[model samples]
Target: MADKVVVFDFGGVLIDWNPDYLYRQLITDDTERRRFLTEVCSLDWITQQDGGQPIAKGTAELVARFPEHESLIRAFYERWHEMIRGVLEEGVALVDKLEAAGVPLFGLTNWSDETFPWAWERFSVLRRFRDVVVSGRVKLAKPDPAIYAEMYSRIQQQVPGVAPQDIVFIDDNVKNTRAASALGWHGVHHTSAGATEVQLRELGLAFA
Candidate 1:
């Protein structure tokens, strides 16, 4: 078996980030909080920012649409740090094991360029990556083939003759994993660290 090159998706996989962490503090009522998150500041809305839209523009446009929830919408970016709880320890452990075994590692995350700096400072695990492809910085996000292609190019530069089939990509989102798989990568859908470890072992990556 060829030694595997692993690519990680940071947000839900390695980092525990949820908008509810901040929204819970601001909106006391659970129902109202759910409604606001679904209606006003949804994933689709933030994804545009992740795809390189300026925070100011995304916030202003959102505020304009939901004028009554102005404070809340603005807080999404202004108080964005609160949204992060911390690193997923188990996931980080997996990364540690991989590195110790001399596996090549890279990151492909759909994160805002402006907010990524905050995460970089807080999470040491992120620095563990040999290189990271930030969607906001590159103007391409996950589930988009272009971003995966870009990552593949970078991987080739580092690993020389590494083929796509020899790369294993772990992501919390099924769509992202599927996209990578479609392009000849070994995509592992990460739900939990234990489950991911099982999948990795099955793929002949016995890093334990």
Candidate 2:
């Protein structure tokens, strides 16, 4: 049997990325902040960026639609790095354990091509991954089987003899995890670092 490899999702799984953290600072009124996030810079809108839309174009389109909220929309990408609070220490520690145990690490994340640089610059833990498939760069996102297949292929290429079934994918979204499971990869629906550590242990991955 080929050795098992661990695949991780970046956003909620390893990093604490919340737009509200940045939006709350920009828009003082809680109600108005919520409104802006919901009606203007929504998750759906951001997903487009993740799907390879340039931040410049996305912000411009949103500004054209909601002209009055232009500045707010511009701030979305301009100050995007501020949205990421930091790496989840527990998650990082788990990764560290996996690394120490000689397990190969890889990342698969639905992040904007333009804004990913900010994260790439801020977080050193991301560098630990042997390879990372970014949605924006590849123009594919999670819950889409293509991206998962791409990740599997990339891993296979990097780690010779590894098969799809030998990979364990960890993601915060159940849909993404399910999609991975459908692809024959072991899926871990990450709730907490401790829980994930338990799951990895169950899989026979030694972590001290």
lDDT score, candidate 1: 0.94
Which of the numbered candidates is closest to the native, going by highest TM-score? 1
Candidate models: Cα lDDT each: 0.94, 0.90
- The window of 10 residues in a row where model 2 has the poorest summed lDDT is 199-208
Q: Give lDDT: candidate 2, residue 58.
A: 86
Candidate 2 has what TM-score?
Answer: 0.91
My TM-score estimates for the predictions, one after another, are 0.96, 0.91
Stretches of model 1 off by over 4 angstroms after superposition: none
Clash list (residue pairs), candidate 2: none
Steric clashes per prediction: 0, 0
- lDDT string for model 2 (100-198, tens) is 989999999999988788789889999899999999999998888999989988998989888778899999989999999998899999999999999
